[model samples]
Target chain A: MVHFLKHNYQDKDYFFLWDVESGSLHNMDSVAFLCAKKRYDKTLSPNEEIEYKKISSKDKDEINAFFNQMEESGSLNSPPRVTYFKKNPDIVKALCLNICHDCNMRCAYCFAKDGSYNTAKEYMTFEVAKKAVDFLIENSGERKNLEIDFFGGEPLLNLDVIKKTVEYAKKAAAARGKVFHFTTTTNCALLDKETADYLNREMVNIVLSLDGRKATHERVRKCLDKTVKYEDLLKKAVYIKEIRGDKSYYVRGTFTVKNLDFSKDIIALNDAGFDQISIEPVVLEESSPLAIRKEHIDEINKEYERFANIYLDRRKTSKWFNFFHFMVDLDFGPCVNKRLTGCGAGTEYLSVSPSGEIYPCHQFVGMEDFIIGDVFIGIKRPEIRKKFSEICVLTKEKCQNCFAKYYCGGGCIANAHKFGEGMDAIYELSCHMTKKRLELSLAIAGIEKLYSINA
Target chain B: HIVTLFKSSLDKNHKTGCGECQSQSCKIHKKM
Candidate 1:
């Protein structure tokens, strides 16, 4: 499939085309864009006053020849092949330790059932956390650098486990000649100076949760404590920003149906002194009131477009910040295997529950059917690992015909299974948003490239 | 006119040699 988009940046018209299998980008002029679009859709007809309708027969043939040349160079219409599946034993590289299953806030759109994961509220003991580290090192297989994310209903609730886990992991990993890269996700509601200092000194990356503007954040992420308002949370987050200067972090927010104009939320984050930001669309059941429905896709797409323009304007100034979804690494994207298989949730990465029970990823923590094994015993179900190992674009029938298949890697399996029919089916809403984000990201990248060349 | 902006190394014929490599982690893959 030919994946291309027409965009207007600062009154400059441009077209961005993507080579699906090769993951390459080409910027096309209007003539080439029209010709390529027509090629992709044979019955496409231009309006009477349009430029394509006024093209000479000779010029049309020349455009066709150019397309043929591009096709011959394997830069257009080249489909991906189904390669051999590599299923190595004991190659897991990352673990998300859900240290606490209890949260301080009652976010209406929370997927973790208000941080309890649909179970009783609990905290991971130091022993379980220590075993999790040992489990990671024992099963890491020749991997030198390992990743451990202190995750949960708010990992700071179980502060002792996090501190002890980090200290133990460092000592154990040093003895085993393995390096640990630590990260954590927090709501910043319980962030104090002492913990903030400790996190700054220990963690490599921290994700601070704030839902953008005061009203928008207050609408969904309701703190249980009446006294702790949005301003209070923002103060704590800003303190982290002050202490953790230049360190990698993001102020992550979620937008529901209530806040379709989520661009304002992102801008609020940038204005709040947070540079790296990611405001994601909330995934909820259709029955839920706050869930983003099929009809909301268009408005969300427009919001993204508006945000892209604002992002471009900010790029020219000193106040610019990075938006995670809009950022793409052209120099070296993910490897072909990774691009095909996606995040490696079940195989390469696993989530450890408070009790040391292991699931595929954080999303699958409480589901009994998805329980592969515990950290102490290691992955017991090879069949589940095999299932995720075979999860690639080629294996998923719905993804085979999609233009954005390679970019998203068939999307999150948990969402597909929860929202769609099964793991093989695509979540249509998420897929639509993904395509829009990819298009805008490519357009921004191309526009910047042109600017640099002209300058 | 058409300008090729960036072509990734993960083309159809690109070889990762994942099977022979001792370390399974790629820097870009780890970001995901």
Candidate 2:
């Protein structure tokens, strides 16, 4: 019941104990770490047991009393009971509009299957885009700000539609006493001065795709014309960074087995003047050549530590940018709704395909089974909505036992449905990576806090 | 034996009422 994970930074002599149930973090000595592990009824490793034996009886009793006090304070074993927002359905707060399911590039690991989502290549019409915006406004309930993400094979492919959609959402929201926050994810293949200017002025955030280094990026992401150069794309992205000024943007990359040394890619993006960077591992079936497999988890885990060190190194400079996964603000994390139920996919958020059909999220856009409703009907399938609404750490049997349960919110439902047993099941591979990243995040936060305190 | 670095609970925080947080990282992930 004392759910906690003992973690330490690489080559650091100190250890940290994270009380998962309560989100309480502590800096502890090695003996206390091993002692807490044993007292929690967890079996210690041979080396840990050896160290455990070295603890004096008095010290052991003191640590036990401390843990007992924490337990008595309801911070150790008690997991909060979460009530699903089913009785009163959660108001939709965000939507990912698949503006155009057609891409100019051929990326091997693209989940959208070259932006078509394995469907007929299409673009969302102005009418459909307008309806999607209206759907968001109608369902947003008391929420003032609604989020609409311009997504696609490459959102900029339907640049005109994106602009029109933004215009429509802005006008519609203002009239209805609601505000819309716009975001777009692009390959930067079709980005130009005019489009960048338009996006900079309209979008609150933009995600630019660059798969790390040139070799790694080119290995998977290729232009249809074959004449486009990575340098050209990089130039345009850098231009956006400059012109966008203070508005948020990040260069996101996907690393496959072909690039296990993905930390170098984060460095590459940083070196290229991109401060806010995120390089994520590709999610592919193991049979695929580019897939990150069981064999590669160890290497990837080590890469995470390597990236953590580099992240800390950058923290000492003005060049530091927020790494997506490593941005762990312990004092101010996600709200209770998000912490318990994860990203509100079906309930509080939905995805709109080019034709206006609604799915649970962007990852489920083309999958027919996931289509809960269309923009016209507005969530017709209450049963499907109920299923999504029920998803949470408490509902997931595996997550209930996981130390990282609250942090990950039972992992991605899309990944669970695709790779695991079902929506309630956890994706083991992603779970492994999530735990590693969480560990590193805590270590980074602890190190920074200690450093600041010392200074 | 224990030096508490940071400790806070979801229930104790007043910001749990709304989704709006200045941290764009949360929004970016929510949108994703």
Candidate 3:
């Protein structure tokens, strides 16, 4: 079948055709699009009657020429194929170390069971962290570049271990002729001058959590005792800005149902001198009060539209700002081509908990069933790896039929499990939101293209 | 071909990648 997807933006229709067997993208004209769509829908056959009731002879000839060209390119042929990745134990690329299970703040919609993962609040010892690093290096195969992310209830809570781990990883990488990149995700509540200086000197990529406005951010992300104010967090953000200047650091915000006009948050962050900002929907149980419902999707879509407008306006004025998700290569298609799953969780990416147990991603840190292995033994159950490796959009029945399957990558596995569904099951709200976001991104790209051509 | 043309335009405007230094260096640089 000739698999392709179509969308209408600003009264202009666009079609994206894909050669499933070759994984190559083909540009489709209106006639080619109709032909491909009808073929996929089984309403038209290759050698069947040309329905010329709606088309003139000229258009019909054009359609026939396009169809013949596509056929010659082997775009219409359905080649038998299977997508699978063989287990290569030595190809670890990225590892997220759950440095500290203890957290200083008690955010309202924290999925990590209030940051401790519902387990005892503790910090990962340097020994366990060192082992995790060693495990990464040993399994890193021929890969020279790797990444280690400092994650936790708040990674700063275990700054000592992080410092040691970075120091060790640097030497270990040098000795093995590998380059290791370090990153940390912090709530910014604990970013003091000393810590900021250390992060700056080490060149660690920092991802700070700051939900848009003070009122909205405080409503969801608050201190355990509700004493740490938004001003305090802002001070840390400014401090990091001062120390790191423009080094790569992202100001990430989570927007729950409580704050649907997330564009305001992006604006606030931009006004606050943060250039790289990303605001994401809070991932919560579908039944949770904070979960984005069907009714909220429309409002969220409007917010994205507003956000896109503001983003374009900034570009027009020569102002510098980047909305994280909006930073997509519309021309080049989805980032991963070989993977069936998004983010390569259990396979390429692994999160090590404070006690040394490993899970697919950071979201699965505390979940026992999701535990794939431990630091000492290394990937205890290869079966779990196989399961995750085998899972792709094709394996997902819903996603197989989704127009946004290639882009969405079957959604997040952690989210699917949160809705009490299998890995292949994506949350309906996420699916809708993602498809809308992709559409908006394409529209924005379209507008930008027009401007560039005029220039 | 349209996508490629669009991508070339975007690249000409320097609106490409994640807008970060791919080198992953420590030195502070202005946002592009």
TM-score of the first chain alone, every candidate: 0.95, 0.94, 0.84
Residue-by-residue lDDT tens digits, candidate 1, A1-455: 57877889888898878877767788978888877777775655557237667777897899789778777877777666444544443578789999999999999989999899998998999999998999889888877778999988989999988888899999999999888989999999889898899999999898999989999999888888889989999999989988888887889999999999999999998899988999999999999999999999999999999999999888888878899999876656656666665767887788999999998889998999999899778778978877877676667777777777767866998998999768867788999999899999888988888889889
lDDT of 3 by residue, A1-455 (tens): 44555545446665666444433445556665565555556565544335424456686566666666655654443342334423333356788998998888878888887789989988999999999999988887766777898888899989988999999999998999988888888898888888888887875578889998998988887687567789989889877876777677889989999888888888898889888889999877668988877788888988887777778778676467888877655444432332233576787778999989988889888788988889999988878777777677777767655546655766888788776366757778888888777766655665676558669
**Which residues of candidate 3, in runs, are more than 4 Å off?**
A1-90, A225-227, A242-246, A331-341, B1-32
In order, the Cα lDDT scores of the candidates are 0.82, 0.81, 0.72
Per-residue lDDT of A261-358 in model 2, one digit per residue for the tens? 99888888988899888888888877899999888999999989888888888878977877988978777576655576567778787899999999
Q: Is candidate 1 or candidate 3 better by lDDT?
A: 1
Q: Looking at model 3 chain A, report the run of 10 residues with the lowest lDDT sum.
A: A332-341
Question: Order the candidates by DockQ, highest first — what do you get?
Answer: 1, 2, 3
Q: Estimate each model's TM-score.
A: 0.93, 0.93, 0.81
Selected candidate, larger DockQ, 1 vs 2 = 1
